[model samples]
Target: FKDATVWTSEEEGILVHTDVLIKNGKIAKIGKNLWAAGATIVNATGKHLTAGIIDEHTHIAALSINESGQNSSAEVKMEDVVDPEHIGIYRNLAGGVTSAQLLHGSANPIGGQSAILKLKWGANADELIYKNSPKFIKFALGENVKQSNWNSYSRFPQTRMGVEQTFINYFQRAKEYDLKKKNGEEYRHDEELETLAEIINGERFISCHSYVQSEINMLMKVAEKFDFKINTFTHILEGYKVADKMAAHGVGASTFSDWWAYKYEVNDAIPYNAAIMQSQGITVAINSDDAEMSRRLNQEAAKTVKYGGMTELEAWKMVTINPAKLLHIDERVGSIKEGKDADLVLWSANPLSVYAKAEKTLIDGAVYFDLEKDKQQREAIKKEKALLINLMLQEKDKGSPTQEPKKKDQEQLHCDSL
Candidate 1:
């Protein structure tokens, strides 16, 4: 990409009329008049270039997001159910999102393990995962896990206090299990306890689904008791209330840009949650729990500017470097550093502006989405739909039997919906 206004997302701010050279799927250099032999140069004059957006929370590629039948489901994994053909992946790429943390639903207090994936549209499920990414698990607190809105009451941990005990009890069991294994005592292997043992051993991190301040504080305390730190708190709408505690605990905050009042637990949610947490020395990242919201995360990051007086660089970092750091993939894909992966977006305008559009999105230095190509694909889809409809009409005129199309309902899965 050459002659573009670049938002490098590094310590130094934006660069004007800069050239970027990508080689072997990594950014090789960033300077004026950068040249490479036998390389195809992209003319990005009058456009904007920035690191591709990273969504800290999402459930786009999964066939099933939850195993709510159990109180703890650490055995299940989001990677085992990834669907590469899901159109949401392509849509996200078009919106400049290159990577996302595909998390499990917040049905159980201890949810399943998560999968961090790159938005490589045509790749198979195995190819989509970010290779060698750190392990992460989804934990939940407050109403959703306790079944506050559900009609059924058979699940365990129906109260906040019960939730806290659940973590304590499980961690204790996991510790005992680890001790037995370490001492070479013969014991039955448990997948759930084994995953928890990894956390106790600092081999895994937790990205918890949370909202209320009290529950957030409780989880942190529980983690402290177990000698582990909660990696991040997702959907932390009431985070501002306990910003100091969370900061002191060394936990990151991955929250919605501005979400509130959708449920009783979130009544106290405020738009300034991210900025407030940032002010308290906590690393904050804006995340999208919804599929539609995941596509427009750049616009979501821009909201912090209006709601919390964050500068453009800080707001943009929430969706880029901040999320990368939380997910432990910052070294590879977060910023436009010389040795980083070439996951980037060429925008029609400033990414923070509402008028901006992702003209081209690149993952591994390959164009995954281009505005002109998208237009052609849309036109092709329309033509194909019309042709199919015409063929159906001909079949009807010939007195052929026809059946009504089946409508399969896509389940609306979110952090609270479970």
Candidate 2:
């Protein structure tokens, strides 16, 4: 039962006093005060129950966010490098996050692949993956790759043209590599280019890091030349200029809420970027490139109202459905509908409010986080730690040191005394 504000997929929005029945990790039924036999019911009466928030772009849980040693480093996978116990995962879940696209950093021209992850707290890495998630590559543009922040004296692709060329060069190599592999040419294995070749063959999609109009157009041309589409552009600060082109190219754009002026290339970024892109029929999503912004994703969606006058539901879609669509996991996790995995959150007040708190978070029919349980867990952890520390100190005061290591050292010394 989604207790707070229940948002059902039906035309009616935020049904009050609703009872939702969940069975076998799927919503069985929804009605006001509905009774079900043998079903575990959740009383989410004062919570805002809706689809779990999806963070379209983030670097949380990565061993390293960047692989900048080479221009193209697509061999690396975020899954292989995830740190499941990152505090950010728990924090995001507390903010109603259920899934995230853990992306590689934009330190290189062609970065590694991104992994779509469900925020299954307390689960191992394998259990956290969204089953059958689509494959995606990370292609970066503008200052991050050009080394504009640092001295560009020794870096490859120092100019915008060089960045475009780097992309093109890689695609060309990938195309040939793919052709050889397909024809059974028995060529030496190259992991990096193997991933690029997947993009060339339309087996994987590209999510580019973009800013500035010229570079945006350049990346699109490179994608077109390689006979594959650029799926989405993350942080497309100059997207307003090429919104129509992005729409025509069938490329989605995931962008910041109102970020600007953090760098020289992003000086022209306007708050209405999302609205402008959406106006041109481009599928747009608001993302948290920063860790802190990810928690209050509802507020990020609200910025569209101030900037472009988007409806509340439309704005909410930017953080929910649109991101799920871009990640190609829409069918499973984006909305509160019957038959979808029951990944949802219940909030204490209007989710967009700064004061709102997620009362409960559920994933795959299991209550993963409950506010009250979390509070108790925190207190228990503190008490346990304090007790353990005191016990260690007591042993120390009694002159009973950790004896295993010392015993080993003494035994070695005694043997040497022979």
lDDT of each: 0.93, 0.82
Model 2 regions lying over 4 Å from their true place? 2-4, 8-13, 183-186, 382-418
Best by lDDT: 1
Clashes of 1: 0
Model 2: how far is 240 from its true place, Å? Answer: 1.7
Q: Model 2 — which ten-residue stretch has the worst lDDT? A: 409-418
Candidate 1 residue pairs in backbone clash = none
Model 1 residue 315 CA deviation in Å: 0.6
Candidate 1: regions farther than 4 A off: 406-409, 416-418
Question: Residue-wise lDDT of candidate 1 within 236-316, one digit each (tens)?
Answer: 999999999999999999999888998899999999999999999999999999989988999999999999999999999
Query: Which 10-residue window of candidate 1 scores lowest in summed lDDT?
Result: 409-418
- Winning model by TM-score: 1
- Residues 252-318 of candidate 2: C-alpha lDDT, one tens digit per residue: 9999989999878899999999999999998889998767888889899889988999877778788
